[model samples]
Target: MNIRVNGEKIELSSTVKVIEDLLVFFELQERLVIVEQNREIVTKEEYQSTKLGDGDEIELVHFVGGG
Candidate 1:
C-alpha cells in the first residue's frame, strides 16, 4: 500500500496493516513518537488498532533529545 508519511510518499508491504506495524517497520516503535493519520491525531493506545489504507496521509513526529 502507498501512504504519505511526513509529506513523503512511501510504499509499504502488505504485512504492514496498522500504525504499530508501520512504526515497527520504520524502527520507531520504541521511540517517543506522535502519529497523525489523515489529519487526525492518533493516540498511542490506538496505534495497534488503527488501520491504514492506500493514499492515506500520515505524519509522524518523534522527539530527539540533545543538550
Candidate 2:
C-alpha cells in the first residue's frame, strides 16, 4: 500500500496493517515518536487497533535529543 508520510510518498509492505506495525516497519518501535494519521491524533492505545488504508496521510515526528 502507498501512503504519504510527512509529505513524502512511500510504499508499505502488505504486513503493515496497523499503526504499531507501521512503527516497527520503520524501525521506530523503540524510539519516542508521535503519529498523526489522516489529520487525527492516534493514541498509544490505538496503535494496535488503528488500521491503515491506502492514500492515508500520515505524519511521524520523533524526538531527537542533542545540545
Candidate 3:
C-alpha cells in the first residue's frame, strides 16, 4: 500500500492496516508523540481503532527538550 507520511510518499506492506499498528511498526508507540491522520488528531485511546487506507496521509510529531 502507498501512504503519504509527513508529505513524503512511501510504500508500505499491506499488513500495516491500522493507525496504531503503524505507530508500532515505526517504533513510535510512546505517548510523548502526537499523530495526525488525514488532517485529524488521533487520540491515544483511539489509535488502536483508527484504520488507515491507501493514499492516506499521516503525520507524526515528537516532543523534544532544548531550552
Candidate 4:
C-alpha cells in the first residue's frame, strides 16, 4: 500500500496493517513517538487498534533526549 509519511510518499508491505506494525517496521516501537494519522492524533492505547490504508497521511514525531 502507498501512504504519505511526514510529507513523503512511501510504499509498505501488506504485513503492515496497523499503527503498531508500522512502528515495528520502522524500528520505532520502543521509542516515545507521537503518531498523527490523516490529521488526527492517535493515542498510544489506540496504536494496536488503529488501521492504516492506502493514500493515508501519517506524521510521526519521535522525541530525543539531549542537553
Candidate 5:
C-alpha cells in the first residue's frame, strides 16, 4: 500500500491496516510517541481501530528530552 508520511510518499506492506499497526511495524508500539493522521490526532486507544486508506497522511512525533 502507498501512503504519505510527513509529505513523503512511501510504500509499505498490506499487512499494515491501522494506525496502531505502525507501532508493530516500526517496533515502536512500546515506545512513547504521538501520531497524527490526516491532521487529526490519534490517541493510542484509537490507533488499533483507525483504518488507513491510500493517499492518507500520517505523521509520527516521538518525544525526546535533553539536558
Candidate 6:
C-alpha cells in the first residue's frame, strides 16, 4: 500500500501490515520515537494491532537526548 511518511511518498513493503511491522521493517524497533498515523497519535500499546492502509499519513518523531 502507498502511504505518506513524513511528507515523503513511499510504498509499503508487501511484508508490512501493522505499525509494529513497519517499525521493524525500518529497523526502528528499538528507537525512541512517537508514531502518528493519519493525524492520530498511536500509543505504544496500539502499535501491534494498528492496521496500515493506502493513502495513510504516518509521521515519526524521534526523541533526542539533550543536556
Scored by CA lDDT, what does every candidate get?
Answer: 0.98, 0.95, 0.88, 0.98, 0.88, 0.92
In model 3, which runs have C-alpha deviations exceeding 4 angstroms? none
Off by over 4 Å in 6: none
What's the number of clashes in each of the models? 0, 0, 0, 0, 0, 0
lDDT of 5 by residue, 1-67 (tens): 8999878898889999998887788787887989999999999889989999998899988876789
Per-residue lDDT over 1-67 for candidate 4, one digit per residue giving the tens place of the 0 to 100 score: 9999999999999999999999999999999999999999999999999999999999999998999
RMSD of every candidate to native, in Å, equals 0.5, 0.7, 1.4, 0.6, 1.3, 1.3
Best by TM-score: 1
lDDT (tens digit, per residue) of candidate 1 on 1-67: 9999999999999999999999999999999999999999999999999999999999999998999
lDDT of 2 by residue, 1-67 (tens): 9999999999999999999999999999889889999999998889999999999999999998999
Q: The CA-based lDDT of model 4 is what?
A: 0.98
Measured with C-alpha atoms, the lDDT of residue 5 in candidate 6 is 87
Cα deviation in Å at residue 5, candidate 6?
Answer: 0.5
lDDT, candidate 6, at 22: 87
Model 1's TM-score against the true structure = 0.97
Q: Higher TM-score: candidate 3 or 4?
A: 4
Q: Give candidate 2 misplaced runs (Cα > 4 Å).
A: none
Could you tell me which residue pairs clash in candidate 1?
none
Tally clashing residue pairs in candidate 3. 0
Clash pairs, model 5 backbone: none
**Runs with alpha carbons beyond 4 Å of true place in candidate 5:** 65-67
Query: What's the true lDDT of residue 35 in model 5?
Result: 91
Give the per-residue lDDT of model 6 (tens digit) for 1-67.
Answer: 9999899999987889999998998788899879999999999999999999999999998877889
